[model samples]
Target: MSPLVKKSTGEFEEFDEQKLRRSLKHAGAIPSEIAKIIQQIRPLIHEGISTKRIFNHSFRLLRRYSQECARNYSLKKAIFELGPSGFLFEKYVAEVFKAKGFKVKVGVVKKGCCVKHEVDIIASRPDKTIYVECKFHNHPNRKNDVKTALYINSRFLDLKNNKANEFDEFYLVSNTLFSKDAVKYADCVGVKLLGINSSYGDDIQAIVNKYHLHPITSLQSLKKKHIHALMSREIVLAKSLLKQKKTLFELGLDEMEIKQVFSEIKNVRRSYE
Candidate 1:
């Protein structure tokens, strides 16, 4: 069951067990680990926080003594995971915006500091540009969520100051839903929040289910509509590999390697719809 449902007032109501399992799983915690941890902390979690916030609570508790361990096993993975997640999410948002007549550009910035901070998807129509930041965190708080927005906002300001023909709008997206305060902060800063689809949630669950069984990963094997969504990424990687053309054809991409890249391409192409 979904832990969230939109209320008449446009707010989301939280569920208990739904929060516990999803957050725990997102933090890279298995059921056994969560059972032990929750047995101890369940009493202390205040009523204000939902069950989903439990992962954040556990992470904060562990961060004091094992920063690197906590980060590597949980926090850092979630942060880095945002890059690929952003690539997928941007395709959806860009298509939606474009169908509504907005001009959308994907991965266009190729020079200078702008290159260092490429906005995921820029939705524009002559007079305005909208910068986007995508998040795929385990447990993003109001403060944590705002940090990326702040970075993007600062970057946008710098670009604008340099007369860089920038957009006036901004956006933030996440596979994980934001807290009330996170939404408020985004609104206050003129950042629009885009909710992720349930299908993506199912994809994460499938990944987790597969991991628990210690099965081989078939992410590089699945053929999906999102494959073309990877055009720019594949082009960039192919170019880099081409530059090191010592082995070229001799590198001899075996069937598995070819299948893997083909799977990646298929995944991106599916994103167009």
Candidate 2:
């Protein structure tokens, strides 16, 4: 019988190796590396093992096998590092939209029919404009619930009514998943949602991977202070680091540290190629 593994949400279920295998494959691990990782991980599995422990163990092994794969596997956890505040995640989301060819404005205050509201993001293309509300949580199991969707939709309606022609769509995006009630509410109201496992086919993870917009926090080489410093300079994406050699120097990264940062960046870039 499979040992029961505890999830981050405090739920328990029978361990499924196939689920672990799929995640490894998604992280760009080759078949041989995946098998090796599983071989090592299976012995560590025991009753009531936390998913976090399993992840850490797998990540360590994957890092040994390939830096790029480890980085890719760590993407979700890295996003959490974007905050003790949601502001950085908001900026990251803006970058994602910018990569998708939308001209984005973050932290915009627009007057609504009822009152003024500060929007997290306003993404516009030539033909349409989208108002985005970003809900970022540090915990993976934290979900955007029905109340969140209801509030966001109400705000959208106020803005849309006030400037109906200006905004064509509203999107509620998050780094975490949404509850079923949230999804249902959003669907009923015509508000779009983009989060993990989104039915719309454009979840945050998918978009990030699709455009190679991995956040700088995703780099194992960078410390928290280093990440905050880069973000303060508006350098959010890992790809952007390639052109910011001067900024890196200003951040006080010594020769060895800079070399490590650049090396990890190269490996991350190569993962897609």
Residue 108 miss distance in model 2 (angstroms): 1.3
Write candidate 1's Cα lDDT for 15-122 as tens digits.
365566566555555666666666766676553454335555776654444433353343233323334435644554455456446787876652333434666777
Model 1 whole-model lDDT (C-alpha atoms): 0.48
How much lDDT does each candidate structure score? Answer: 0.48, 0.84
Residue-by-residue lDDT tens digits, candidate 2, 1-38: 89999998899999999988887775678999999999
The residue-level lDDT of candidate 2 at 172 comes to 91
Clashing pairs in 2: none
TM agreement with the true structure for every prediction: 0.39, 0.78
The TM-score measured for candidate 2 stands at 0.78
